[model samples]
Target: MHSKELLKGTLQMIILKLLADEGKMYGYEITQKVKELSDGQMVLTEGALYPTLHKLEAEGLLITEKVSMGKRIRKYYRLTETGQSSVLKKVDEFTDFISMMSRVLQIKPAL
Candidate 1:
């Protein structure tokens, strides 16, 4: 598993990118998807995930819908229009940052 410190900084970007691609997902589903995508290398705890999700919703970058699932009500999150645009910008910024760091560290740039 990746260190919490490393995962901490990238969590928001990771969430945004996933929402952009997946359309909408609930908290647990997001956690599972991250784990699957990273081949179990990355796992997000509810402690870390919910706060970030709430923060994004408070910032008006995300909107939620509640759906009935068997005996429970599940809250699903989707990006707002502002969020859609922001994802592209954030992804580009993160890409550039990685490229710059790779160059500085004399490592091959990430694809």
Candidate 2:
């Protein structure tokens, strides 16, 4: 599994991108998708995910719909237009960050 700190840093962008690609999705679905795509190396915890989802909705980045699924109502999240527009930018920013870190953390043998 990946570090919580590293995952925390990119959670919002990841969710946004996922929703952009997959349309409306419930919380459990989102978690499963992330695990599958990352080969089970990354996960979205409730402690981490719900708060961010709420925050994004509050900020107008996401909107939700409640649909009755069998015996219960499920809240499905999809990206707002603004959220879609920003996902690519966030991805580029993350790539740049990883590149910078890679350069700084390059391994070398001591003489």
Candidate 3:
């Protein structure tokens, strides 16, 4: 797995992009989907997951609907209009970020 701190910085964008692409997902489902996509290179914990979800919901970027499964309620989250806008911006930002980091690190060409 990658470092927790590094993943923390990108997790929100990652989640947003995932939801933008996949529509609705619950917390554990989101985490597992990311893990699956990344081939287990990164893992998200509930300790870190819920707060981000709540923060995005608070920021008007996500909307949640609760569904009852047997005795439990599951909250599914989906991107709002704001989240869809943010996803495009974040995708550009991350693309630029990776490009800048690659340049600075001289990743492809040794000095």
Instruction: Please provide TM-scores, in order, for all candidate models, with all chains considered together.
Output: 0.95, 0.91, 0.94
- Candidate 1, residue 67: CA error in Å? 0.4
Cα misplacement distance, residue 104 of candidate 2 (Å): 1.4
Runs of candidate 1 with Cα error greater than 4 angstroms are: 109-111
Kindly provide the TM-score of model 2 when superposed on the true structure, using C-alpha atoms: 0.91
All candidates' lDDT scores? Answer: 0.95, 0.92, 0.94
lDDT string, candidate 1, 1-111, tens digits:
778998989899999999999999999999999999999999999999999999999999999999999999999999999999999999999999988998899997458
Better of 2 and 3 by lDDT: 3
In the predicted model 1, the residue pairs found to clash are: none
Could you give the candidate ranking by lDDT, starting with the highest?
A: 1, 3, 2
RMSD of each: 1.5, 3.5, 2.2
lDDT of 3: 0.94
Which regions of candidate 2 fall more than 4 Å away from where they truly are? 107-111
- State the lDDT of candidate 3 residue by residue for 1-111, as single tens digits: 788899889989998999999999999899899989999988899988999999999999999999999999999999999999999999999999999999998889557
Clashing pairs in 2: none
Which sequence of candidate numbers ranks them by TM-score, best first? 1, 3, 2
